[model samples]
Target: MTIRYPNGQKFTPVPLRDKREQPRDHVTFSNRGMTLEEDINATNAYYLNCGMAVIHKKPVPVQIVRVDYPARSAAVIKEAYFRQASTTDYNGVYKGKYIDFEAKETKIASSFPLKNFHDHQINHMKQVESHGGIAFVIIRFSQTDELYFLPFQALYTFWCRMMNGGRKSITKDELTACSIFLPLGLSPRIPYLDAVESMYF
Candidate 1:
């Protein structure tokens, strides 16, 4: 017998025994084909554990509307959506100062597109800067695996130019000159806080 979903698609049913024997490391998808965001998040975890500068990914809250109670053991999400882009990507206190930043990645080698940074992201960063906090974006060129710590002020500069009919995308050369290059490391992977320390502290 085959179980068909509401969409008229056949649902493959796993044997109960096989389901029980399923691997515990399903979350290890990152280990297999991880992203720059995942690497940076792992690095943040390391920093938190070591009592270093505290930083964390800001969760986008969602209103859960439906869930499937497959069994007493599991509650599966059926539908959900983000409430809004409320704030920056990450925020925390670092050495008596507040820190806030967004992380982004792009494959285009010549330039980082302005579309990557939304107006809300820029507005939130501006608020952080106004309050005397550190605001920046950690951008990664996925093709090269190179990362940079771009300050919010510098971004705002380019943002102004673009708003006034200038180049829409920032060239890689401009990024290299305006931002601090983050050192890649084996232990922490991104080693972003190192760049932060060198800049502020």
Candidate 2:
């Protein structure tokens, strides 16, 4: 099966290693082998299972253009196009507060590049905040296995700084000082709501 974007760009699955066959010890950290999207999706599943939250990844809608019938019972998609997504990555309700955020990971040890974000995402977050919703970012340093909860206000400030000739990214030192660290756990993996409690409550 093949998928493509609305603009005719081929869609590639987010790179993910086969967890069943891979050695668990291959990476030092619990999240070492997992991509940011995978971890967040898994964590959201955990949350849902535990009745902690109802967050979920928004499906990337696609427009199918071609299909082939290899067998009577099997229909394979040969070509497709992805449609534009209108919302952030994950969202749901937690204790009456609407939670919405995007998760990103970087290999850089010192700084997280602002280029990691897109204008549409920033606008989405701003909209979330404007409506009195909980808007934030969960960024992980994959090389260090450190995750931090960066509030939208701080993120917006950083964005402004970058636009005004400041550094194009946020340094680890800055994150350590300004963001709340999310301790890794075996179940939910990213305990970001803990950071939310500390900052908001």
Candidate 3:
């Protein structure tokens, strides 16, 4: 299948590993070569099962353009295009508070580049906050296996600085001061809600 962005650019998805070939070591909080999305999905599943929260990933709207009828019972989609840009990765309600967040991972150890975020996403988060909703970001330093929950306000400060011709990235030291450090665990892989509770609730 071929998918394209709204701007007519080809969208190639990252190849995923087979689950059957992966190890089932759920005892440790190690990286285990899993992608950030996979970890968050697992955490969300656990949260749902435990009745802790109701969060889900936002699905990207796509317009199907072509389909191949390979068989009478199977019709394969051949081409599709995204209808619009996504606002955020995940959203839901927790403890009666609306939650919305974007998760990103980088291998850089010194700083997290602001280029990882888009202006529309920032604007969306701001609107979410203005409407009395909880908005934040989950940043993971892949090299050091360090994770941080950065609030929308803190992120807005750096974003504004960048727009004013300031530093284009947030340093590790700055994140340590402004963001909540999240330690990975077993039951709920990335325990981000704990940080959220400490900061917001």
The TM-score obtained by model 2 is: 0.76
TM, every model? 0.77, 0.76, 0.79
> Of models 2 and 3, which has the larger lDDT?
3
Query: Where does candidate 2 stray beyond 4 Å?
Result: 1-34, 67-75, 82-86
Between candidates 1 and 3, the one scoring higher on lDDT is: 3
Q: Which 10-residue window in model 2 sums to the lowest lDDT? A: 24-33
lDDT per residue (tens digit) for residues 1-201 in model 1: 589889999977765554335465321121123477688788888888888878888776788999889966689889987675667768898888899988877767778877667688899899989989999888887778888999889899999899999998889999999999987887688887787788877
**12-46 per-residue lDDT for model 2 (tens digits):** 67766666565543322223445777878888888
Among these predictions, the greatest lDDT belongs to: 3
Model 1, poorest ten-residue lDDT window?
A: 25-34
Residue-level lDDT of model 3, residues 1-201, one tens digit each, is 568889999977776775556445321222244578888999999999999999998776789999999866788889999665558879998999999998887667888888778789999999999999999999999888899999999999999999999998999999899999999998899999998899998
Q: Rank the candidates by lDDT, best first.
A: 3, 2, 1
User: How accurate locally, in lDDT, is each candidate?
Assistant: 0.80, 0.81, 0.87
